[model samples]
Target chain A: MNWLIDFFGNAANWSGSDGIPTRILEHLEFSAAAFLIAAVIAAPLGLLIGHTGRGAFIVVVSANAARALPTLGLLVLVVLLIGVGTVLPVLIPLVVLAVPPILVNTYEGVRGVDADLRDAAYGMGLRGRQVLFKVLTPSALPLILLGLRLSAIQVVSTASVAAFVGLGGLGRFIIDGLATKTYSDVIGGAVLIALLALAVQLGFTLLNRVVVSPGVRQVR
Target chain B: MNDEPLVRWDWIARNWDNGGPSAIKTLLESHVVMALLPVVFGLLIALPLGVACARWRWLYQPTAGLMNVVYSLPSLVLFSIFLSVTGLTQSTVIIPLTFFTLAVLIPAVVDGLGSVPEHVRQSAVAMGFRPLRRLLQVELPVAVPVVLGGLRVATVSSISLVSVGALIGQGGLGNLFIDGWQRQFYTPIVVGIVLIVLLAVLSDGLLVLAQRLLTPWSRARRRTA
Candidate 1:
């Protein structure tokens, strides 16, 4: 226990490239970048598919398939295929990981827009693009945010896998500690990751409240 | 000899047997034990808690809060925390995985029960069915399709997650990834990834079959639709 206190207490551990702060930043950067890419790709695609009602079968099967893929396996494969030491190995798998939740939720969210509401928009002389952005997107916002919440937290938790491939994140403390047989560092690392995850969860709750419309927030 | 580690046919062939130490077969055996045990135990524990939540209704919110905390926590972090308490052993791995499975299963099970149509319960009551008997005989049978669907999601994810336990030298098929990483060999890593996915797919198919076999009504409904 003293080891944990001492570990964090060291002012030196709070700054610099190898510091706790830096590692936390790295973890957040990885999660945010992957999430942004996934949302950009999936959310738009979901709107198109949900609007047209095409590719429902593909979306369902792929979402299930994506979740079952081993992160470590994908990590190693990506690194093997495209040589490691770059950030792509970690970033690519995470984008892949983040995609399913966002895509599925976005698709479901758009698909779930009330048919009457959609018909009302069409009757108003709204074209497809206007209907999607105005009607489906707002209606789907609650679920889209929910999907983002799930994806963000998941990517953050799993980002530690990057440490295995010789990248630094919050996982560095856990992975390196294990290799060095430093028990305290390992425990401390785990504790920090848990804190970060909880923070993300809490942050999402707040984000959901702020971003979602009051009428639809009741739906959640 | 070219060593040919990427497509190391000879190395892979030798390491695949059931007879050898750390063979793929042996790893898979241990993997099944470590992976499936958590989902089984999680089902046992979660189903009841979920039912309790369904009954109480108020319990759902708190139960969800607890499950979220568990689900959001990284598997690597959770395993290390257990490692400190249980020391280096399979129990350390199993305990965390059980919690992970619970995070998925409880919500699924609870929703499955809750999603049972209100009128169905009302009719069952009008038919002189007691609350307990209605739950067991009426609600449960109707709930099977939804519960089984949840189980498929929970179990497939569990199999993949069990591999994360390799960080502490405790996961089953994870040993392959670890070993391959150390040797810079691709054979075991590729085999491990491919096999775990196939296993998830196959298991998912079986569960779908279970849902079909158990819920002829749902299947018939689908047919009519």
Candidate 2:
């Protein structure tokens, strides 16, 4: 416990590229980038399938299969394929890790909305896009947010693991510390990553409360 | 290293059994043991805890909250923390992995139990079945599909994560990734991924088969619905 305080309190650990602040930025950068990319690709596709009720079998099967992929193995393999010392290899696997939860959750969320509500919107003379956006999206907002939150947390944690392959993040502390046999560095890195994940979890929870409508929220 | 093909059958054959600790066979065995133990142990522990959570409404939230926190922490962090106490051993890997399995399984157990219809429980009570007998004989049997669903997730994730243990030098097939990366050889890394995925898929398939066999009635109800 004292080592944790000493590790953080030391002024030297706070200023360079090796510093805590820079690592946190790098960690958040990759996590956010990967998550956004996944959302862009997955969320719309999920919504389309959910609304049209088409190709769901493919989406669900692939998502579940993706869950079984080993993060470290995928990271290493991608790094090896693309050659290391670049950000793409690290980002690729994190994006892969982020996609399944978002895709599946979004698909399930939109599909789970009341069919009658969708019909009511269509009957009111709303076009396809409007019905999807106005009717289904709001009704499915909670689950979509839940999916995003799950993806974000998973991405954050895996991003740290990606540091093992020489990407810049808080995980550098753990990898470097482990390499140098410095226990304090390892512990400090582990603590910081855990704290970051918890922050992501809390952020999403707060976002859920703010973004989800009260009527929709009560249904949950 | 750049000149070498992506995979060398010769290298795989030669290193298949040099009698070293990092042999493919040895690593595969270690990986299976480390990955499976946690799922087995986690199920054992989660069943009662989940039942309790389901039985006592208040216990569900706190237990689920704690498990979520545990799940949120990356496996690497948990591995590092346990390393200090357990020291570079398989137990270090297995213990943390068990927490992960429990995190997934407990909620599953609780949810599975919850899925039992109120009428079903009432009928059991009306039949004079005690709580324990009712849970084991009636409620639990019905809960099989859901619990097994969670079990499949737990099993697959556990198999995948055991490889991350390699960072601490205990990673089973994960060691292959480290080995390949250090030597700039892609064979081991490729082999490792294939094997791990195969293991996960095989285990998941087995669980699905188990679910079908155990809950034949659930399938019938689904079809009719």
Candidate 3:
């Protein structure tokens, strides 16, 4: 359709605008920051919760509840509290969104470890921490990596919500296009988001191959 | 005794006087109505599609792969595509949402059918039941729980994603949130968020209740505290 051509033609024009690259970088930067922070906080807590077997229910329920909160609402609320344009607006909600998959996967992975193998570890007089690190962690790596893959994909998709707060990303194109009724810009932005999602998914698949042991992968 | 108005409460009071309550009700009603149609339609289409997919391995892989792509694309992006192609309207929302539901439900239905015990299918055939009768009589009952689980996920996702329809001027809870954002009013945003969360939880709970009612045989395994 002529509309499609016009849209693509206009999108090409916007490529020269500095906002495009800045928006893309800011989006990635926010997503990466949120993911790293969440991984740091969640991975260890997941390990602790899984090892102890206490509070597993509480952690998972809380995380799921948190994930269910509308990202836009959270972004607005955080912006209200912290004021707009700070990185916190983007970071906090993503951390909340990213946590559930990571925690669930870690807990499930650790809990899923063969009971006999764990018993063997314990029978060797390994302390709780020793067993967790030496026995549980390595064995649970594949599942935990799966969780990380899921979390990364989620974070990538969600990071676009940052554009709602006037923080920049591929969402900027979509939002701006909507306002102006520009179809091509909207499609361009969407294509970029989809591409980003695919890239993240593929990235995790590669990471899963490297980080997950073949023996563990086969078990599942 | 305190007369000082809370900013949050004051925002709500002003909006309430401005017909916010009616707006909220309309929004809730619209959301339920919009979400229900796609869910029903998608389930109807997906059930047979899934069974067919399960039966034919060649069709299974391509259909499943396409569904995965549909699942991964953001709801807003889907809405935008629909809007541009069809022009903004309820059809845009309904069509894409239905497609999205099918994307999830079909795979789930296929998985559910596949999960039915091999022996059960074999026995149905042994008894001389035709393929259709066997599917309906044997596989469907067993597959109900798994299919319902997928429906539950799809339903919740649909409810949330339907809010994106508000972007194109379709009135729903998402409209409240967006209007609040434009007006810089926090109350409508809060009300919208609370309403959506409530809708999701309530609907999911209802689905679970339905699962229990429909699958009484599975109830014996339910943990009794």
lDDT of 2 by residue, B1-225 (tens): 167688899989988887998889999999999999999999999999999999999999999999999998899999998988899999999999999999999999999998999999999999999999999999999999889989999999999999989998899999999998888889999889989999999999899999889888978998999
User: Candidate 1: where is the Cα deviation over 4 Å?
Assistant: B1-6, B222-225
Error of 1 at A198 (Å): 1.6
Tens digits of per-residue lDDT, candidate 2, A156-188, equal: 889888888888999999899999998888999
lDDT, residue B75, model 2: 91
Residue A53 of model 1: what lDDT? 97
Best-performing candidate as measured by TM-score: 2
Worst 10 residues of 3 chain B by lDDT: B1-10
Task: Please give me the DockQ of candidate 2 compared with the native complex.
Answer: 0.72
TM-score of chain B of 1: 0.94
| Model 3 chain A worst lDDT run, 10 consecutive residues | A11-20
Give the DockQ (2 decimals) of all models: 0.63, 0.72, 0.37
Model 3: lDDT to the true structure: 0.77
Q: Candidate 3, residues A48-137: lDDT per residue as tens digits?
A: 889889888867586547544666666665665556666776678788888888888898889989999999999999998999999999
Question: Candidate 3 has which clashing residue pairs, if any?
Answer: none
The worst-scoring run of ten residues by lDDT in candidate 1 chain A lies at A76-85
